[model samples]
Target: MFLEREEYAILRSHVHADSVDLVDALAATGLRWSEMAALPPRDLTLHGSRPMLRVQRAWKRIDGGKALGAPKTKRSRRTLVLSPYLVQPFKRNCAGKQPNDFVFTAPEGGAWDSGGFYHAWTRAVSTMRVGRPRSPPRPVTASPNDRVSTTSVTRPQSHDLSHTHASWLIAKKVPLPGIQARLGHESITTTVDRYGHPLAMLDDEIIEAIEWSMNPMAA
Candidate 1:
């Protein structure tokens, strides 16, 4: 379905098992299409108590094809931790593969290409009847935006998992500097640019704590 959060949840609740895996990897990891496609098997590692992806090289666009390149930005070359939910599927898929093997490969053992992935994704989304386009928000953008129409809302690219993860971290009040490192941003600024401060979920907590400390009588 289109990239809207509600639509995504709905789709997740009902999509086929294979499609669900694809969606989970995309939405939870926030990896770009190419990065996801080019993920090497060796990137998967065991973290504190979970599996993590050691991001290093990324796939770059080349002469009418794709080639290996440095990570997206200097900051993008870092490790990414994943929950057991994610690691289980990975282990199952990686059964006998070598470390140099692509993390997500085609049946022929070739690397994943976004073009093919997109085609498959679109078909899956369509089958699920998710994020169908409707009347445009504005007349001007309607034509371009409604390129794909269904009965529900529009779907977004899977890379939005990065934003989702960032938002979740912010909402949980996770430490900022740590997040910056996890996402491999050159600077916290880069992370902030892509993921703005989480909506102020801490206002009540901060206010209550201040009030309690100020009024000894309440304590």
Candidate 2:
């Protein structure tokens, strides 16, 4: 898992349903930060055995700014399994909300203000002091052509959570195809390219299997 045990504890304590949905969206779907931000409540299909979160578009960062656009690739327009743990909370958050609502909208009923999200992230990370690093400052450069103002306070890149989820799958011996599907990766190659290494158990399994196989001859 990308979150250390302590980090999970801190997040569990401090993060509300919306924040947890954000994390689950990343960990389960391997969506980029921008993709998560663009999630529409209408995309949630609750009729399935496992509810699916449809990703219709992803926000793009261009010319030093970001905005919603067609999905970067056809592969990006896939559905993801909404984890069971998140379903109830997500339902609660969406109670009486509009169908087109942004799933992780600000509590004020508006799209998340990036600056505010970063600020809240900073505050949350600050509370999780043990083995967790402080949030970094946002980088700023003059962009007179840019419409979206860059974040003033830098936030740590959160994609590490994707890596963590992938690693957990590999460590748990989940098949590659399954991981690729859950991650909504276009190909197993993408999954392998990003998180291909097996966990410590890979070697241990090989050695233990070898020993067991050889020991049978001694019986």
- Residues 1-219, candidate 2, lDDT per residue (tens digit)? 255545555654665554666665566666777777777778887665788788887778789987788776777777777667667756766677788777777766677767766766666655654343344433488355656543333323466667766776787787778877666677878877777454454778778778988896743
Best by lDDT: 1
> Tens digits of per-residue lDDT for model 1 on 51-170?
788778888878977789888888788877787779876776667888988767754557766776666666655666554466444556566545643345666445655666666776
Taking every candidate in turn, the Cα RMSD to the unseen true structure, in Å, is 5.3, 9.3
What is the clash count for each candidate, in the order shown? 12, 3
| Collision count of model 1 | 12
